[model samples]
Target: MGNLDKDILEKIDDWLSSSYDEETRASVQKLIDDQAETELIDSFYKDLEFGTGGLRGIMGVGSNRMNKYTIGKATQGLSNYLIKQFPNQEIKVAVSYDSRNNSQSFGQLVAQVFAANGIKVYLFNELRPTPMLSFAIRHFGCKSGVMLTASHNPKEYNGYKAYWNDGSQLTAPHDKNVIDEVNAIASVKDIRFEGNTQNIIPVGEEIDPIYIEANKALSIHPEAVQAQKDLKIVYSPIHGTGITIVPKMLASWGFENVTVVTEQATPDGNFPTVIYPNPEEEDAMALAKKKGEEIDADLVLATDPDADRVGIAVKNSQGQFQLLNGNQIGSLLIYYVLSAKSDLKQLGNNPYIVKTIVTSNLQADIANHYHVAHYETLTGFKYIGELMTKLGDSAQYLAGGEESYGYLVGDLVRDKDAPNSCAFLAEMTAYFKSKGKTVYEVLLDIYQEFGCYQEKLISLTKKGKAGAEEIQAMMAGLRQNLPTTLGGIEVKEIRDYELSQTTDMKTGRKSEITLPKSDVLQFITVDGDVISARPSGTEPKIKFYCSVKGTLHDKSDYLSLQNTLEEKVDRMMKDIVG
Candidate 1:
């Protein structure tokens, strides 16, 4: 391209002369001959980074894009690391993909790389969700695994998520060490393209039954499900991998009346039904909501592309459909699990649940009422898995969730699983229905027992290189000028997770925080409001989490208290941004 950086030109030349496929070379040459300056700069300006999860980028024919070369390099690097980590043992890895375009080819490419490197590979015969990949790794006793899907992202993007033997994403030293090995890859020629087909074993039929049975074992009230087997439920997979297992899981859990949104039931990479293939958006769930109304269903559930997160809709007190945010869902799930166990006298010794620091504190109050231990980790699910691994044999993990619709019920799979969550959610609906109460009534009852807690998340996205720099600058500005008061209330404490210290702003006394270092800051006000600021690890955006609470003495006061909390959150956000 004309006026391109010299180094970028050199990289382009290298790719042209390298051992890449003919199609890739033709695309690069066309861009150069056409003098596509903007396209060239965006494609070749920098290399795509393998973050804590693994590789994710827009697919194209450049170092910064997700293509055959980048996928091969990541797989080779992971092969090398696994070989070193498990010396003297036969290293094995599992591979799976989603319904996205080219995902099957990319997944086969990964399996070939691992097999070429003399590593045993267990590849799925067809597309599966990310959670099943995690379960397969632990079930087969593989040393590592890789999943090829961009969870809830747009159609143009794809990603690779690496997992360890414990079935969790990389954490701490392992994550950084994998990055070093990937960066050391010098050329496309270094990747092994030819493979021993015998080393690649297809796995699906053997694992699906076990996985489904394991989830069915998590149900606490099978009797209630049997009694209320006719509870009308509507579901939509949003044209993702959930269509493969979610319906099957529901059937096995003794639910009789289940309706699938036929239009959105098929798995398609283009996601033809919605603008964004995410359950968090109301527009994405519009079709399912309409289906629920026509059928007079009691609940509506929607899952994203990879089926890792789930969102639900239920009738409110006024007999109108209302969407429950992630915080509300998490609260209801934890309350159901804990209270059921307590009622059955199944609360064992040292029982615990986990949540992220950005999640609602209502979880902690629920745990206190049940006399169970509650642990808070950083924002990622890997951190929750890490804590679970660390507390091995000392505590039992009941369930855990984040505020972004990701959750897990048992310890069999370390990652968040929608199939498992859906099964339990259906059971939860049946249990309350058996008692002649709607889910909305159960939620109000929970709030009345424990104070009403409302939370909102606002994300500001910054796009390319300049946008990244601007996000960092915004964080720096907040750290440099700490607000003394927010929402007309005095600031009581400041917790700087980056420094691993909590400071009493009124007295200037600091206390050590016993958690891993992260670039997050939290401001706690005298009125019991919490404001947290942190950047997204997977996307080019920064997020602000605001939480407020009020007394809900009666069902009539619900609307008034909700309005007051919303106003308080608005004021706090304004103060922080100003």
Candidate 2:
């Protein structure tokens, strides 16, 4: 503690003397007395700034933490921004939280802040999914909304995701503008802490049926789902908000043999079943997969804490249950929607699909096969949502997703909708099953049509301040020393997203990239393989996305080609990162 900088000491002292509660002050004092220098500095070094995911951080008592004061200050800042954005009108916001520690309390505090600022607040009576919160904002026609959950992060963390009236998360100008308002608050005294009870409306189950019905309408093949109504489906909420509505939504979708993973059906912030609540991880989906095997289920679905992301396990050609990666699941969903629409001759005018730049290009190929348009955005669902909003009623949005288990079916909810995706995914499985085929066999068939593509994601986490600096240095090094080849293949071109240009290695020709500028770099080999590198917006890590493709002319050749592709991805990753 004595080694702490003078400014840090001042910040700590201010917390002790300010209107901070006794418990918070005593916790800071204990850190000082215990000579916890690292913890103190880590806790007081800086405020948690908004990123692609809004305000998120470890839950504790500090400016850098996701505590009451921080959440309150953020909400107040949002209130100020909303007032300025829509002047002289009654400002309204929908508020909800996930099943995380202190999530409900933080949500209540946010609602109170908005209410105290003379804004109308529609607060959920209990914990709910982030997608539902997004839907509520649009359905109620509110000015904005906020969801309190750390997403798939560890239990020690909590976060706030602010959304606009379109039900999408904040984008440019608004995101930074809200932060500017937050930075203007010099003290906790500046925040409107007092609540206007009348403005704070407690909303309950009345909105549930409306949201469920909207999701039910996303089904494209209702007749097929009805035919295979007993499609042995297993679901696990991963101890998050999905339990609130996912099961009911499945029932609404006409799935009769749905088995909710009994061990993890409840919404608990502790997330005791798995180390990480994210369905993207294999461990998190273990229970669901086990139940799928025991019950001989056709599909297994697990949603993250906020229900924005989902992971599934389907039987492979070997009759063994395997957890499909985000790219696989996303491709399956895209193929299902496009193929169905094409067969039904219902390919709406200007129908299009969207995916992140880091996702597999197989989606683009599938969309092309059906003569549907496909677009790519930066690696965040917010950007996808922004594009959907930008397109509006002009273009029909079929589906969109990222490689992180986040996916969306219809345009109704502007975020990745787990329950909706589950319904659609289950329908996909059932559709193929009705044709005497499994989803896995259908996936192989897809590879047969469009060349087989395998993708790999490697994330190197760098935690704390020093780790952050290390990540920055790593990115700099990557940019400075551009590789000329990968996996023994000549690098044909380089696409530097930060510079918003693509440079051809052979001719040194340059072309401007149209998407928003981001600190990402891509290497395209002469053989059409692609590898991208970018730092994560929400967490302290840098990630590399490698995709390699090969032709699969026969079903029996699937495993052989996939194995070779896996090796190719491994070599490419080693060459890029090492």
What are the root-mean-square deviations of the candidates from the true structure over C-alphas?
1.4, 1.1
TM-scores for every candidate against the unseen true structure: 0.97, 0.98
lDDT of 2 by residue, 214-321 (tens): 888778889889999999999999999999899889899899999999889888889999988989788999999999999999999999999989999999887899
Highest TM-score model number: 2
Q: Assess each prediction's global lDDT (C-alpha) against the native.
A: 0.90, 0.91
Locate the minimum summed-lDDT window of 10 residues in model 2.
Answer: 45-54
Model 1 earns a TM-score of: 0.97
lDDT per residue for candidate 1 within 374-471, as digits (tens), equals 99999989899888888987888998999999989878888999898888888899999988989889999999999999888888888766677999
List residue ranges in candidate 1 displaced over 4 A. Answer: 1-3
Spell out the clash pairs found in candidate 1: none
Q: Please, what's the RMSD in Å of model 2?
A: 1.1
